[model samples]
Target: MLQDVKSYLGRCFAIKDLGDAAYIFGIKIYRDRSRWLIGLCQSVYNEKILKRYHMENFKRGSIPMQDKLRLSKSQSASTPDELKRMQNVPYASAVGSIMYVVRCTRPDVALAQNITSQFQHNLGDIKRELRVSCYSNAGYLTDADDLKSQTGYVFVLNGGAVDRKSDKKSIFATSSAEAEYIVAFDASNEAV
Candidate 1:
């Protein structure tokens, strides 16, 4: 396949044989031909993020975002000192680091990452099992400020989550059932 592609594309691409990438960007790639499996991890990337944010030695938490912690645009910097402190907080960078993990190996933290991302412009502070089935869920009017519902879904394969998403519904849901229906639709869309 490589030779055919090389022949078709001529020599402009400058493709080199890297011998089965050990890491791409920050993700560690693993392959087990015996089991017909491939795996990706971001432990090194995670460590860098923790160290960057000075959380390397911090205690672990059961939940990525503590329950009932609501972040809103209202949290945007108000006073001059607050703005200065926010500038030094590296909130966007931290969210971006977590986002890379979310895009790579940790779907369990999708909700937390999504929420953190919403607050990235302002400021704010900030897993996996293998399974094949997906679980879908929704919360009605969960966004305290917007009255929009939220949807969360995870697709697990081989005892680990391979795909996941958590986002606010584009439209407001009048009832919990409608919110659930919207989430189910979103999940099915992802499955397809």
Candidate 2:
């Protein structure tokens, strides 16, 4: 059927068959006809980013971000020397690079991506299972700068993550329970 359509289109327009795609826009593609499965990966792109950032020798961590990690504006460069030092770091560029990976094949890092993006002007370090299930959580008043809660959720499908979000709530929650409720609402909305 694919060949027939290709031939039909070919008759009307100039076209070339490059055969099965192994890579597109830097994401590598893999297929298993016997199992009828297809997969996309960006290991090469990821490695290049690591190399570009001089993190090729850094130790790997089990999680994208440290547990209970909190970032605030106070952590930003304060003094003239600190500001000068931060100017040399490609903070925004690094975050943009990792965000590309997150959007493409790493939903597991969505939370980290969201968190890091909040501090684009401050400069900072850059940093999945499938089950057709979702998990949501909130950190009450986690944003020290605004006293807003942080909400996050991830949806998994077939042992891989399919959707995710991590961001500060637009409204402040009165309690942890309220924060959780908000996150749940957001997750449910996404599920629908």
Candidate 3:
């Protein structure tokens, strides 16, 4: 019967019996006899990560990075020199979230998470100071302290920075023209 076949296959593949298929491989499963669809979303994974990392009680953020969020380098971080130690950061929670979704073909966050993991330790030391014209020239001129969220966002098109950032810029601009001038120069140099 179909039940026997399902059991055999499930055992062969090492699947847990959830009774009803609610999810699989990070995808939320829904079925209809006449219609079919499968979607990969962050909902369940988000909750799992929150709970595992003890952030489950945090007010669910509407945006990934808050406008007022800030992380400064003043706090001394424990930078492990060994690669093995790097894997054991108390906060590997950020990396775990990326892996589950990445293998499922969600490519949007690939660059962001990769960059985050690289700076796993000594994240504080990497911060740059404010009010420097050089930062503006390089297209990073916001408060560096506020840019420490575990995600990255880039909005570019045709190989240009429509909006791109690894972290926040280090300084606020006094005027639009000054900001644009700096951005233009940076992009031109990058293209070359």
Report the Cα RMSD per candidate: 15.7, 15.6, 15.6
lDDT per model vs. reference: 0.78, 0.84, 0.52
Q: Which digits, one per residue and each the tens of the lDDT, describe model 2 over residues 1-99?
A: 998999999999999999999999999999999999999999999899999999999754333345476788877788888888888998889999999
Error of model 2, residue 157, in angstroms: 22
lDDT of 3: 0.52
Residue 147 local lDDT, model 3? 35
lDDT by residue (tens digit), candidate 1, 1-192: 977876666676766665678988868999999999999989888888899899999744333344466677776777788778778887778888888788779888899888767877766322233225879999998989999988999876555566789998889898999999988988898877
lDDT of 3 at 11: 80
Model 3 lDDT tens row, 22-82:
7666677665656675555657776887787788886442123222334544443555454
Stretch of 10 with least lDDT, candidate 1: 123-132
Clashing pairs in 3: 141-169, 141-170, 141-171, 142-169, 142-170
Off by over 4 Å in 1: 1-21, 31-38, 61-69, 75-77, 124-192
The Cα error of candidate 2 at residue 91, in Å, is 0.5
Task: Kindly provide the TM-score of model 2 when superposed on the true structure, using C-alpha atoms.
Answer: 0.58
Candidate ranking under TM-score, highest first, comes to: 2, 1, 3
Comparing 1 with 2 on lDDT, the higher-scoring candidate is 2
Which ten contiguous residues of candidate 3 have the minimum total lDDT?
Answer: 128-137
